[model samples]
Target: MSGAARAEHRVLIIDDHVLFAESLELALSLEGYDVRRLELPEEGGSMATIRSLALRRNPRTVLLDLDLGRFGDGMNLIAPLAKAGINVVVLTASEEIGRWGGCMRLGARRVLPKSGALQQALATVRRLHQGLPVMSPDELETLLDAWARERRNHDEVRQRLDRLTPRERQVLGSLIEGRTVRMISEDSVVSEATVRTQVKSILNKLEVSSQLAAVGLAHQVGWQQGV
Candidate 1:
């Protein structure tokens, strides 16, 4: 069953490291899977690219790198890929264990450190494709605990975001886009002083001290326009 499954499985690698992606593609191909590679997409377009590729290739699994250098975090692609019915196995250089929790909650099937052996990574992908659990009992428990904590943090962040009034939310959207007080004021036909006051209110409601901090917090909770 495993051998036949391996022959039919398609794996897509989305990593910005050209050399590493090439090597992984070769390795997977040698292991009897149809493998494809794609560098990270430009900012704000990764989700669409992943959806389109998944629709075209219909890969059974995706090996994703969380860090895409200048492109941005590959974590953003997990949910969309999963929704497209592709199993995602995270291949990351990130040492922070907390990030693993986030990835798993976002629909990744497994997380493999880039420091691990290539053979082990390949085996994990195979297991996932065969509908097997990748984590041991202990690891599953740890992941559940970490996921619970992350959920709590996410809820708190959402609560803070809910404190903003409609106009303040608009100000925040402008702020995240790198718009200055004057620019936002002129564009919205509001006074500069009014923009400043709204900015202060946004900061206070978001529980951040400054505009930069507010922007950072907004990103942490996956805040975007109309969301």
Candidate 2:
């Protein structure tokens, strides 16, 4: 439980999907690897519950899914499982490269998109079983670098959004909804000049010269109008 698994060929599947997990378990079991799968618990899956299951089972490798439905983000368990010396292999339906990049950054030995994942997953597990690196140093570098670049851009967008006052954000949101300054002014029962001023302040705080640019920035960061 603390270091290596009690059994070298044992693997744990932690996906919520029943059919996929069963197919994988059957496949692995046929290949002479001991396999166990976690079903969605009575209450629902959770990071805490998944972590406890892994610790209790102490498999050499864990096959994880990101969107656990009721369980929430599976990314939360990657670091802890890796730290406990269990190899984490993320198998996800999401096609986003950012999410794949995040898996490696969080210590997943391999990440497989659910599309055509069977062969890739088997190969990864085989390498891991042999104590060989699943990803080359260069491939690992590429994924980690992509993760870093994405994180940097996300942080910048969040910082710019954080600079806006509540009123300015509401004004920006109105703009996002395609409301003109006059319309926003009428809704707020303020003068056109006042709404225009707020719009200008939003542009300044967002470091964009035009209202369109400000709106685009807000949208990029997933900002919403505050109540």
Candidate 3:
């Protein structure tokens, strides 16, 4: 390829998987793209490095890995990269479809599962370079809607959780751990009546009619104490 073609095909990969990154770099380079993968530090902060690079030599497209090891979060880098007028094509091994929605909402041009073949990835890059859309507008809109719904559900869960006192949170945690009300009361050295009152409060605060429902919600949303 000519120097001008390589210059126009500049691409950056911010992935920690050394072997994969090197393979992608070689593949892209072979296809005439001037690809470079960020050399991650031992501890992380890949977003900082990406921001620094964007200021110096921003590429036309970025093939980002969702998990960056200690190189900080790749998810957090999407908005800023897109805001910089760079097209972002997320490459992730995650099976979570909701996460792909988050990526699209965060301004990713495309979210591709890493399970795909290298030829598919190469084809995606070629399409982008030729000024083509990787996915349809309808597909993009659907993912964006999914993310919005997920965000709403998250905020609602958080708000309900925030209403709990520390004791209530502890009780909720115990419930999640499969402790019975009587057992919890015995462990805390409290009366059975007091434990029942706390259980009622927990149900009220969580807005769930049953203890099982509350526990299910906690696990589903990946609830953690102190949020």
Candidate 4:
């Protein structure tokens, strides 16, 4: 495509985190994207509003959040955009187990954690422009391991994940979906204490002080692929 076409790639940031979302919008615009920023939707903005944007602007890609202030999830918007033939890339801070797989299965074209630096996100967008999978060898390894461990015991999996786990891998997938610790405990059939310990361990292993930090780290890496 010509420079104009490439420049026409509309990028929408649908995040509830106003500051970060605005920063992303500014950054992406600086990087040569036709960018639009939508503050986290209240009760998830009307699907009609989104459809209108997609149909009118026909953005080349969308930067979505998995969780949007409990109003609606970025995942909820993926299918509609996909049906409209728009490309979607997740730009959330969710690190729950199985979330990566779930987003992909739900038809998101790609997932890039906002924790990842702007350069990395830009690289992925560049690849998207070129019609290629953006994952590098290392990112791919982390992603696959993350997807795999969701099915295994947390302790058993953490040992393996430590080597190169996806940054800030979230608690079990269900927990991040607004489920309670007791609920997750009930679902996973583990004690609430055990769940808390696992969450702590995951936080420690990832070297983050909070759950959001862990989630953000999933996308940020000091290393580059094929270096």
Could you give the candidate ranking by TM-score, starting with the highest? 3, 2, 1, 4
Off by over 4 Å in 3: 1-7, 44-46, 173-216, 219-223
lDDT of 1 by residue, 108-138 (tens): 8888889864777789877877788888878
Clashes within 3 Å, all models in order: 0, 0, 1, 2
Give TM-scores for every candidate, taking all chains together and pairing residue i with residue i: 0.63, 0.78, 0.79, 0.55
* lDDT computed for candidate 3: 0.84
RMSD of candidate 3 to true structure, Å = 3.4
User: Which scores better on TM-score, 2 or 4?
Assistant: 2
- In terms of lDDT, the poorest run of 10 residues in model 4 is 218-227
TM-score of 4: 0.55
lDDT at 96 for candidate 3? 71
As for candidate 4, its clashing pairs are 95-170, 116-219
Those runs of model 4 whose alpha carbons end farther than 4 Å from true positions after fitting are 1-3, 39-56, 136-227
Instruction: Name the top lDDT candidate.
Output: 3
Which candidate do you rate higher for TM-score, 1 or 2? 2
Clashing pairs in 2: none
What are the per-residue Cα lDDT tens digits for candidate 4 across 1-227?
A: 46576677888776767887888788877777788876434554565565565557677787777776555556778888878777778876776636776676667766766686466677777788888976556655566577666645444434534543332233534333556668878877889898777777766775667756654444332222111
* CA lDDT for candidate 4: 0.65
Per TM-score, the best of the predicted structures is: 3
